[model samples]
Target: MASEPQYRALFLGAGPQMQCGVGQFTRLLGEWIEKAEPGSCTTLTLTRSEGSFTEIWGAVGSARSVVCNFPIVAWKRVMFTPLLAMAMARLRRRKTVLIQHEWAGLHWLRRITYIPALLLANTIVMFSPLVRRELAEDSLVGWTAKKCVLAPLPPNIEAPAGMAASDLRRRLVAARQDGRLVIGHFGSIYPAKQPNALLEIGAILKQRGLRPLIVYVGSFIRGTDNVEEEFHARATELGIADDVIVSGFVASDHEVFGLFGAVDGFCYPLDEGLTARRSSVLACVQAGRPLIVTGPALPDEFDHHARFKELIDRGAIVLVPRGSSADAYADGIVAALKRPPVQAAFDFDGWWQDVANAVRAQL
Candidate 1:
């Protein structure tokens, strides 16, 4: 047999060397494709320029198609490595796909660098109308608009098998038994994520004569502004520092979901409101606990994510207005905990299949 191309596609990714969610997404997607089609895709994890070119180009050369998810937030050294490989693939006449995970939220200078990748990709996939709208606002990538198509962002984390929610719940039972509410916030802690909202809400909960324990299942992003320092400083100011817990980076999905299981309910008052791009929220909803999230700025936010929409329709998730006061958020938090626990029927596997099929169609 001729060894023309061992894999159906070459998936370029920035590995989990930093605080990037795309890294997790890239790995999960590669695993799913392999399961779905047997010998379908090869995932090449890139870290900066060290041995990236030869390996990425070799993978690109071996496969029938190329797919890359761009904008590895926080790690700029290897940011454009995938695009360079895509250019090489195009030179060899291979069709290239770009998964645009972010844009509007990035700095203007960073958005400028996306121009080359936008032009190099044969097909550009966006996860939401909001992202498409953001991309369209910039005339730099205007020509690639026709090549753009919308896709769904499935949860980055799946509930680990055999991880009993009952066992996990026992860990937090002592605090709850003492009349304390555990309010969980998932994903990288940063100002954009409004982690301070957790502290604020916890303070408000205290003000209303209730005990609140704020738990961050993820860690703070150490960036240019000393994010971790500020988070603790603000917590100190609010006088809830002792009540807060930061789990740092938990590597195990079982542990992550276990923490999810331990919480009374989850809350995220995102600065940008709810949208299709918050993979953490997607993961948290699968815990089957009540979730209080801010309403999306756009009405058609969930158009591409029908599964999420269905969950919202079924009352498994609650959405308060974007600028609701801390008192209001506190009220929603208390109310969400009181709501009967209804396991969400969020067809996670089905969502992944839809996303995979949509993307493979372009390939």
Candidate 2:
């Protein structure tokens, strides 16, 4: 590989050890950036204990550009605050871009740190318009909002290696029933996923005299609530336990997408509503599967957005309100199943080009 001697970018976030969304995003982005500009990248871990202030300072001092992919949510504030302060103090000497992955700044305590970091960075890359709008309300962040750009999270999933969806589907069902309609939910088992909503959808399908099987494609997160147990208990209560298939964690992107391809439809009931940041949603889009998504809890601006309007016009996604009753979700899912499958396509190269252009403009 040819070395790009004069150009360097430092990425700070979770590495492979974290085994979470932030870790995956950080690693994937760093890999792509290095491929784009060989020998011009440095990574300093943030989620892992190996991350040191000395290492961060050393990289920031020499790199032409730096990207901090940090999660500033309240639960993470304790860990992120000091590290962020250390990085920001030295970032004034280089072109810095902060990838704010979550809407942590919605809280006052977190915003006190977030606002100054936004001001110090040369640019900000936000995941959703709602977060961007919230940050823009601040006079300081708003003044520089022109420098902020929106790059929706890309799907980390890929088609399974040499494995046909039909073959995988047969294997998945060998121990279970073979004739039921498979409805899949991917990502970590969390309340935000609304597993209970899936049971409700199943109950509705049963009422309509159809056999529906619920399939979970991800593992449970430790230290959080016992969502998996809760999901099972809820399923038993709904009398759909026998029909549920939990795959635990399918590690490979190939297997994940193969499972996705095998499923009849995908349902994601996110508490935050449908936004660009949900990689699970991106995964569904990549497979071109029929989708049932939850709408924003409150009246919001996304309805007016061109991208969302285009999706609705194409019948690519059906939206039910956040915290909507199971019946409402079931209705949305039923309607989604009836629609012709629309191949939702993403241009990953174009997306990365936009990211590269943003960084180069700052440089």
The numbered model that scores best in TM-score is: 1
Cα TM-score of candidate 2: 0.76
Candidate 1 lDDT (Cα, 0 to 1): 0.79
Q: Compared with the true structure, what per-residue lDDT tens digits does model 1 show for residues 1-363?
A: 535877788887665553367676766677777778888888776775453667876878788888877754454657767778889989977888888876777656767878888999899998877777878777667667678898888987788774544333464666788888888888887667878877888988887778888888887766566778888999999999988888788767877887887788888887678888778888888888888889988899998788878878877778989888988888887887777887745677887887887787777
- Model 2 lDDT tens row, 12-50: 655555455666666667777677778777766654465
Candidate 1 segments whose C-alpha is farther than 4 A from its true place: 1-7, 14-20, 45-56, 71-74, 108-113, 142-145, 164-171
After TM-score superposition, what is the CA distance of residue 315 in candidate 2 from its true location, in Å? 2.2
Question: lDDT for each of the candidates?
Answer: 0.79, 0.65
Cα-based lDDT at residue 208, candidate 2? 77
